[model samples]
Target: MSVDRVRTAAAARGLEIEIRESPRASSLEEAAALRGITPADIVKTLVVKGRGDQYLFALIPGDRSISWPKLRALLGVNRLRLPEPELALEATGYERGTITPLGSTRDWPVYADERMTGRRVSMGAGAHGWTLFVDADALIASYDATVADISDPIETIR
Candidate 1:
């Protein structure tokens, strides 16, 4: 049903996409390998909590982690945090690891990492055991996402 929602949303936006069945993987690298793409080609949708009842989606590459400081500056907010999995599910109608902007119950604003531009990227398909592929540029344009350097290499964060 979630996939159906995603499909409907994509159609409404005239955004072309491909959905594929995929096995669960233990890590980002494994997920990318399963999808036949590099880790950077896989985008992670993160639900960030802002002020009361406010949330936004952050699209970061699998090889990077959200840069909280950069994001805060971009959002012009001093505070932002990731809500618990349940809250995220309630916000986006998709479980963690399967969250995508498409078909979200609410149309939260999207912030995408600049590195994803002009490339094909794999992302969650609003359900487990599935992956959605789309043109990053089109996705950004479709959502009118704010594209910026909002992420840092995962190693730097670690």
Candidate 2:
């Protein structure tokens, strides 16, 4: 259902996207290897619960981690924590490894790490062994995401 929803949405936008299948990747590093792309090109969709049970999505480069301070500052909240896998699945209609910003059950606020702009990115496709590739900017536009520096300091590829 989730993959179908994403396919439908992208098709509606006239996006000719490619879906790749690979071994199950339990982490960003593993996904990167399967996709033959650097970790930076892998977009990690994180489900975060902010103040007052507010759920939000943060897209970060696989090579980097989320900067809690920066995220909190941007959100104007004192704290944030990851929702449990069950809660995330319930909210997004997809499990942890299959979660994608596309076709979420709720149109939560989306924040894409600034570093992902203008690049090609890979994200989950609502199922294990499936991935969706698209222009980072286009994905952000589709999600109506706000671009910001929500990444922790980490080594970057030049």
Candidate 3:
């Protein structure tokens, strides 16, 4: 199972995490309420396509979304788009909402929005209805992710 792979990876890295079941939540808002955290604390994992079939894993706060301009500038790429769902699953070994960098099939490059630091965030656990509650800094460091300002609040953007 994907969640088991995630747990194995965490153990190999000496990181401890708790996987919370969230089968009843129908939306991000509801999930946050169930997790007892503010909506902004949920982290969304996005799979973005770059030039020549390259892909990147972007971590954005649930209340915000990617800023293409900033991401392109940071990546020095001219074109980037969210891949079709099937392609994402093929690349990450986890379905859309359950994708996480922790146990991806490939250790694709990771980037995190600067805002997530020091927050206790809920992110997908590689399974439906499950989320991993983790310390942002610990997660980022464990994954060796590049942290940068690459997103804007959803309302502020579009």
Query: Each model's TM-score, in the order given?
Result: 0.97, 0.88, 0.94
Model 3 lDDT at residue 51: 76
Model 3 is weakest, by summed lDDT over 10 consecutive residues, at 149-158
**lDDT score for residue 118 of model 1:** 90
lDDT of 3: 0.90
User: Tens digit of lDDT per residue, candidate 2, span 1-158?
Assistant: 66888788687766667777767767768878888888899888999987675799999988889998999999888889998899898878889977886778887899999999988889888887689998998888877889999998575669
Worst lDDT 10-window in candidate 1: 149-158
Error of 1 at 129 (Å): 0.4
Candidate 3 local lDDT, residue 69: 98
Question: lDDT: which is higher, 1 or 3?
Answer: 1
lDDT of 3 by residue, 1-158 (tens): 88999898878777788897877577778878889998889999999888766888999999898999999999888899999999999989999999998888988899999999999999999999799988989989988999999998787435
Candidate 1 has an lDDT of: 0.95
Clashing pairs in 2: none
